[model samples]
Target: MTVSRTRRAWIAGLMLALAGGLTPARADEPVTVFAAASLKNALDEASAAWTQETAKTTRISYAGSNALAKQIEAGAPADLFVSADLAWMDYAEKNGTIRSETRVNLLRNAIVLVAPKGSTQKVALEPGVDLAKALAGGRLAMGNVEAVPAGKYGKAALEKLGAWDGVRTQVAQAENVRAALLLVARGEAPLGIVYATDAASEPGVEVVATFPEGSHPPIVYPAALTKESRNADAAAFLTYLRSPAARPFFERQGFGVIGTEKRS
Candidate 1:
């Protein structure tokens, strides 16, 4: 979609929501959200609509959701938490950081292969490419699989294809998704594995392929309100997250809509 039309759609949606009293909150007070870095672009755009529709500000902090979940588990101040997967959300909910009923699937994404700009080397999809040769000029970038959801998905998919142990020792891990993307963008790494949305941010990178959907458990995002939040605006923000105003932005970023509709 054209950037202008996307912007106009956002503005029109916000205006319509406000006129229809869909969102109602005070602008001076903001809801604080801890979100996965993979959502950086889409959420930034969607959050603006929530702000305008409700007259409430949303202050978002992006990072590996697992790290943020650990912080929240250790008492971080946040009105809401949006996790890249259910594991982290389950951790928070189990620890009493987030209300159980508030936890709901938001979106899903897939793992994709991307290489630096102007690189002609194409990654062969047979049992994973030979890392040392395929990424001959630089390290292949990926998030730390221990905690980054994108990395976890990548690893799981690789493991399913019987290539994990073979490539494990040759890996170059980054702190988070964005760092991995940067590795490829700056030519520090010849290729990187990040969410489809994360790769969309850099014209310097191009996706070579996507892991088959059946390769790993679906990559799903979940959001929830926390009991520690005293902000009255938090509920309004959560509601806006599931609205039509935010749906297309998720699609524009290549995220699958999370609902009863399954991929057929």
Candidate 2:
């Protein structure tokens, strides 16, 4: 009887161990997202709302679109990517880092000139506008014009309006648009060229003028699933981004929703 009881106890312990090993881990791991810095405020709010409803979490990394695209190409593990422009998204897609079929244009924005809040600076953005004269010997803050999407758009608009030649030397290029906006807000730069949404997000800056739509390529924010994504909730998160529940946060931040004609 003693021998039999001992054997039964050993078998029961083995069964418990096997059962524990076979049990699956939790199913709600956070989805990792790499997104442009410009989307920080709106995306944060959207992610919060998503988590509340679905009980899933999201981890977002925000930076310049160029930097984020290069990191994705270098094998960063990302479930989703949101770019400030189509060009960087194109780069990721070309490198096979992004799943092209999953890509969608998610938002739109406009470039505008901004000044320190309460400043009386205003200028009409027209062809041959003397932007240098408007600078009054102060530096003009902008993103890295060679790479950052906001800077590229700002440069393109200036070039199209015949203002680049005059103000090119006075530019204080920042790593990203938000940084540029900060320069103006801090009075380090008297003027800044940034997305209209960016100007609106900061209380210390005010929109002075908006670039003409024809001045540069249409500003579109594109989002896609990365090839490295292992998250089961990634596709659902992408869908949620376009859902009515998420639209309000983006719109409140002055971003034009995809399929909608609103502009800030």
Candidate 3:
């Protein structure tokens, strides 16, 4: 009787262990996402949705697209990377750091000139207005072209529009587009160049003019599976981001949802 009871207890313990092992371990796994700083609000919403839908959690790190791209090149343990421009994505793809087939252009945005609401510096937007004359009121604000994708686009547009040479000296550079927007919003700078989405993000900033389409190369956002991702859930979330449900969300946040019709 004693032997039989001991054997039964062992069997019950084994069954419990087997049940625990059969349960999904994704419950504790973290999906790490590296994305552009401008995508903070939109990606946060998407991350919440992914977690709720899959019972898995995501932790995101946001920064300038160039900076994040360099980090990935140096072997950052990121499961996913979302870049504000395709340059970084292309770099990673060519270097075998990201799954090239997983690359997708997820969104688009445009550069714009912004000023603080009710600013004494009257920024005029008439056709053929001289950019140097317009930016002469106070210091200009812009993102650092070395690290920021928006800044790179803005600089390219200024260069293409023949505005960079005159206004380059007046510019005060920020680390990212949102930072540039903040400077203009605080009235610390008379003019700033940033993404239309970044201008829209700040309540106190107003768009003065948009960089003409084709003034610079298209601003495309690309996302890809990173080399360090361990969880299939991260891959799954990337799939969700490409779905119809995410399209409306990106559009409402000022992204021109790419891969969707109507170019909205």
Candidate 4:
């Protein structure tokens, strides 16, 4: 039997969940979250806090927004989804994978160029900055520009700054922003483009420069409950993320709070 790509993706996600020790959720089971990889640190902290306060546990799976959205569409039993961009959230909404009425813009972020901690690279992100010359025959690490939000945003910024043509051939694409960040952090690539929050979370990498505002689409994180979720606490967990209780966790990681605020 030939497996369709969508079905294959669904199977893969199910396998991963089972491998991670997840079972069919019951009312007593933890809230399952499929979140963008960039949200790991902040979300982890916020969710832990929520657990401390409510005694309700959570199980979160992190990946690129595109991959997560596809997994959700493929029938992964995730209770909540937080996407790195509006497009992916829109994708999930359009496919009826999420409860559209529960959707809201949750956070904002910025992109930046980064280098390994010991590297002495300084860049001014502007028109004609000669990004290719700065690479000095090395690769520019980034997420898969075609399918990943970070890569698309990075590509747009580079194009806007007139640097895309110069460094087009030297690009090294990764599966996600964190993987791209690892390339630079491990000194595999002299430079990488990632979210400001990602750079902040990795001590091995240092920000070289921030992309100018308006260079790319505004970075927004939209979140919602999955359509199939039946966990009684899922809605509360989603609300907690927008509450004042969760704002500091996100802010400490350099993410801006912009969701409809909820009372603690």
The best candidate in terms of lDDT: 4
Residue lDDT tens for model 1, 160-259: 8777776777678887899899988888887788888888878889888788888888888988888677677787777777877789878888888784
lDDT of 1: 0.82
> Stretches of candidate 3 above 4 Å error?
1-26, 120-128, 260-264
Q: For model 2, how does the per-residue alpha-carbon lDDT over 83-168 read when each residue is reduced to its tens digit?
A: 99999999999999988888888999999999999999979999989989989999999999999999999999999999999999
- What's the TM-score of every candidate structure? 0.85, 0.88, 0.84, 0.89
Model 3 poorest 10 in a row by lDDT: 120-129
Cα lDDT for residue 127, candidate 3? 37
Candidate 1: which stretches are off by over 4 Å?
A: 1-27, 259-264
Q: Which 10 consecutive residues of model 4 have the lowest summed lDDT?
A: 19-28
RMSD to the true structure for each prediction, in A, is 11.0, 6.3, 5.8, 10.3
Q: Sorted by TM-score, highest first, which candidate order results? A: 4, 2, 1, 3
**Residue 196 lDDT in candidate 1:** 86
lDDT minimum window of 10 residues, candidate 2? 17-26
**Residue pairs whose backbone atoms clash in candidate 2:** none
Per-candidate Cα lDDT values, in order, are 0.82, 0.91, 0.80, 0.93
Ranked by lDDT from best down, the candidates are 4, 2, 1, 3
Deviation from native of the Cα of residue 34 in model 3, angstroms? 0.6
